[model samples]
Target: MSSSSRASPVKWGIVVIIVSLAAYYAVYVLPRGELGQAEQWRVLQAVEYDHRASSVTAEPKLLQNAAGSDLSALGLPTGQKTSPFTWILLNSDSGDDYGPIKMLPQGQSFTISCREIDDVSAKVVIEPAVSAYLKSHCVR
Candidate 1:
């Protein structure tokens, strides 16, 4: 074969290899990468409230990007009286969009500590103060 003909085959081979790699990355790696990014955005940071005085505590209330029923749980004065136990969404930096803690309940006797957890779906534990409150309040 002539030198020019031989070079043509080599160039074609390189092109084929490049195309194959591009296809492999698009088919296998691209989707997973996008999913990972989406998951990172979906990661939610929230506070689980525990009243130190009454010992009353509830689950970690997930902070939403916008205000809604979640605000009511935190006793942010959404004009909803659905539940006596009030929660508060203090601060969230898990994402760019975060809701503010609007209204703190008036005359709340118990002191609350809010902490962030890795997994929002994880089960919330009742703190020692909450346990004591439940014990005393649980009437037999």
Candidate 2:
């Protein structure tokens, strides 16, 4: 084989590897990173997914490790009249059942629990606004 033929495969291999890495980063990392309020929602989703699928505890710290980004400082809504969703409460449960956030008040909120039967279940009690948005976006 000529020198160019040997170099061609190596170059193609390098290109393929680069493309694969780029695709992975684009599809996985970017979407989960901090993008304002969406960051808060995605973090909650990932935590709930983890809780339902494999854990009884839903803690926010674990998200930073999984997403390759520091989401530890991500704050939840405090119902201060910023947005429609501006008053949401974030509840988490490590027991067999979710915390009683529904009875809190008129403000919106969600819970992350682990009383799920399968991985296909979602333990995150998404607010109506978030759920509706997901439905409209076809993100079921």
Candidate 3:
């Protein structure tokens, strides 16, 4: 075969490989990425009261005491640096988009540790304080 004719086969092979990769990404990787991202968001974020305050504010905050609804604290072992509890301040359930969040350990109370940012909520991890709080409260 002539030199040009030989090159045509190589070019066609490259095109085929690229097309196959693209197809695989669309078929397998796309849906999984979407689902995994949403689930990851749920696990990392805990939908908070402030974001959805409109409903509560209109009713002047339902002043009800949880006399019997609190979870009976599970018996956690001693000397545990981290508790079974995880603190994640989730966005509102109106399906607000949370871009990406990363947990960074900071020495502060759990409430103040999380610094909310525009589309990024990565400021989630708190240090020894978080472990202490987790040992006490089971509130998600």
Q: Could you say which candidate leads in lDDT?
A: 1
Q: Per-residue lDDT for 52-139 in model 3, tens only?
A: 2222111111111111221111111122234222223222122222322222122223322211221122322323333344435332
lDDT string, candidate 1, 53-126, tens digits: 23323433434432422221232222222323344432321222221221234334332233223232133333
Cα lDDT, all candidates? 0.36, 0.35, 0.32
Off by over 4 Å in 3: 1-7, 34-46, 49-140
**With candidate 1 superimposed using the best TM-score fit, by how many Å does residue 106's alpha carbon deviate from the native?**
30
lDDT of 3: 0.32
For model 1, what is the error of residue 33's alpha carbon versus the real structure, in angstroms, after optimal superposition?
Answer: 2.6
Model 2 Cα RMSD, 1 decimal: 15.7
* Candidate that scores best on TM-score: 2
TM-score attained by model 2: 0.29
Worst 10 residues of 3 by lDDT: 58-67
Q: Which stretches of candidate 2 lie over 4 Å from their true place?
A: 1-7, 36-86, 89-140
Provide the clash count, candidate 1.
1
Model 3 clash pairs are 46-88, 46-89, 46-90, 47-90, 102-122
